[model samples]
Target: MKIYLNDQLVDADEAKVSVFDHGLLYGDGIFEGIRLYNGCVFKLEEHLERLEYSAKAIMLTMPWTRQEISDAVCETCRANGLKDGYIRLVITRGVGSLGLSIKNCDKPQLIIIADTIQLYPKEFYENGLPIITVPTRRCNPAALPPTVKSLNYLNNILAKIEAQHLGYQEAIMLNDQGYVAECTGDNVFIIHKGVLITPSASAGALKGITRDTALEIADELGIPWREANVTRYDIWVADELFLTGTAAEIVPIVEVDARKIGDGKPGQITARFLEAFRRRVCVEGTML
Candidate 1:
């Protein structure tokens, strides 16, 4: 296996980072999980745009130009002989002092890994997945905006642990105000009365890449859609429910909080979106 560390590719066993790196000590870093399909990096430009947005939001400077980063990502994919896989692009504040100050940090480190990932089982995709709502609330937007996409995922991790302890694979996290924010690692979407709804960014949703793709597909298919605040009741009675992310792609949710959604089966609209998404990925974005 090969890993892209710093500005070059190295053997996975040889890739390493300093123990004092602020990203390790204080979770001071940002990352993007990208997907590659049919020898093409799906939505690669959009992912890089989001990466830039995250860096700017956190005041972290990317040491390389956008073109250079894109080249690095493609190079990493080629080095790993990946035609269909996941790519994780990360930028962390370099080695620093023990204290919380960024003043002593040397520079930022770039790491990219391309590999295959299956976020959920195939049966779940075909049969629809059942999930629960966890008590752990999403971080307040004012405290730590979801748009940053930083390394401090302890909040989501705690929610995931809670769900797993009860024997569930995924969980929904509501904002402090009790409205639906998102799941542990994916964006939430529900179809109701012919209109598709997802939480707005202001509602603590991370504005995921796959979520955007789903919305675009929805529009292309002439499915009415909108972004607004969503609640547990909205999901409980949704005609169809699904989650989207770079890693998770599009997954249908059959049940939430023990309530069966629309005969407890994946809806036709959900299937349409998924099919359209699959078609688009193969022909879209940068080729390797």
Candidate 2:
């Protein structure tokens, strides 16, 4: 395997970063998880745009332009001979002293890795997954916005731990105001009476790329979709439930908190969206 470190590609075992890097020391960094499909990158521009937006939100200056980042991603894929895989693009605060001040860092570091990823087992997707809600509320937007895909994921990790201990595959977290936020690593969606609904960005959910793609698919299929502030009760009584992310793509949730969703099976609309999503990614993406 090869990793893209700055402008050069190096063997995975040889790739390294400074131990004093603020990204590892203080979790001061942003990242994006992208998918490569059949020698093409799925929604590459959207992911790069989000990455830039996240960096700007944190006032972290990226050393490369979006076009350069895109070229590096494709270069990394070629270096590793990766035709179908996952891409992790990271920009860190670089090496810094033991301090919280951003000025302590010299320059931001860039790391891009192309590798295969399967976030869930085949059975999970085939039979659908059952999940539970956790007590770990999402971080308040004023404190640390959920929209930024930063390296500090302890908040979501804590909720994920609770779910794992309870023998569940995933966990759902609510915002400080008790509105549904999202899952540990995916965006939540529920269908009701032929309508697809998901939490808006203002509701503390990360603006997911796959989530937006799913909405586009819904529109193409003539399925009504909307964004709103949803509650636990809405999920409990939902006609169908699903999750979307760069890695997860679209996965049906058969049950939530012991309540079966839509006959304890993946609903017709969920299946339709999943199928359409798969078809779209195959042809509608940037070739490597």
Candidate 3:
């Protein structure tokens, strides 16, 4: 496999970064998980925009232009012979001393790898996934904005560990205030009283690309939807529930915290959103 390191493509085994790099040392970096479909880079521009936003939020300097980064992504996919796959684009604050200060950090480094990823089993998608609510609350937004896709993901990882220890495949994370935030890696959504509801940005949910797509699909299908501060009670009584992300796409949640959701099966509305999402992937955004 080939990896895009900085501006050049190199053998994966040869790609390396300094141990002093702030990204590895202190998680001083941001990243985006993107998907490619049938040679088309699904929502490539949107992903780039988010990356840029994340960089700005952290006051990190992006060394390349949007077009330059986009071209490199396409090049990496081509080098890996990837017609359809997952892309991980990372920009790290370059080498620095042993302290938290960034004064000594030099340039920022970019890395892109194109590979295949199946976030969940096919059977889970068909049968619907059961998830638990973990005790670990999401970090306070004031402490670290949830919108920034930073490398410091230990918070979510801790919640995921708690869920796995409890024998669940996925888990939901609530904000510090006990409001439903999102899952370990995906944005949460539920259908109640014929209305599609999700946590608003103020409620500690990332403005996920797939979440936006789902909302657009809802509008296109004439399905009523809105964003609000969701609670566990709302999910318990929800007619249908689902999660969305670049990796997970749209997967139905049949049960949450041991409470059986509508019929304990993927609801019709969730199925429709998934079907429409699959259709859009093939033809949307930039093609490699």
Candidate 4:
């Protein structure tokens, strides 16, 4: 397989970065996981926009223009002979000293990797999966804006740990205000009174690309959706629920905290959205 290291493509085995990189030491970086479908990159522009926003919010200098980065990501798919695959684009605050200061880093680094991704079992979508609430609260917005998809992911990792310890595949985390935030790497959504609801940006949820696409589809389909502050009580009584992300696109959640969702099966609305999402993957966005 081939990897994109800045402007050039090289063997994955030959990819290297300095140990002094602040991205490794202090998580001074940002990244995006993009998807390619049938020679087309799904929501490529949106992903790039989000990446740019993330870099600007974190005060990290992207080493290249948005167009350059987008071209590199598409080139990566070409190099891997991929018609359908995933792209991981990473930009790091280049070599910095041992300390937390960023001055030592003179340049930023960019890496793009194209590969296949399977975030969850296929059966999960058909039968749905169970998720439990974790004690790990999301970072307070005043402390760390969750909108920026920065490299500092220890908070999500801790929540994942709690889920793993309980032998569950995923965990739900609340914000400091006790409002439902999101999952480890995906945005959360629940169905209440035939309406789709997800945590608002103020509720500490990442504004995910897939989440945006789903919302658009919901609107086009005349399915009502609202960005509100969700609570444990809201989830418990939800008729249907699902999570969205670049990796896990519209996965159904059957039960939360031992409470069975509507019929404990994939709800009709969830399935309809999932089918629509599958169709969009191949037909939407920029074609390479």
Candidate that beats the other on lDDT, 2 or 3, i.e. the better one? 3
lDDT tens digits, residues 165-225, model 3? 9998789999999999999999999999889999987778999999999999999999999
Clashing pairs in 3: none
Query: What is the alpha-carbon lDDT of model 4 when measured against the actual structure?
Result: 0.90
The C-alpha RMSD of each candidate to the native structure, in angstroms, is 0.7, 0.8, 0.6, 1.0
- Compared with the true structure, model 2 gives a TM-score of 0.98
Cα lDDT of model 1 by residue, 1-288, tens digit? 999999999999999999999999999999999999989999899999999999999889888999999999999999999999999999998899999999999999999999999999899999999999999999999999998899889999999999999999999999999999999999999999999999988888998989999989988999999999999999999999999998899999999999999999999999999999999998878999
Positional deviation of 176 in candidate 2, in angstroms?
A: 0.9
TM-score against native, each model: 0.99, 0.98, 0.99, 0.98
For model 2, what is the alpha-carbon lDDT of residue 217? 92
Q: Report lDDT per candidate.
A: 0.94, 0.93, 0.95, 0.90
TM-score of 1: 0.99
Tens digits of per-residue lDDT, candidate 4, 123-142, equal 99789989999999999988
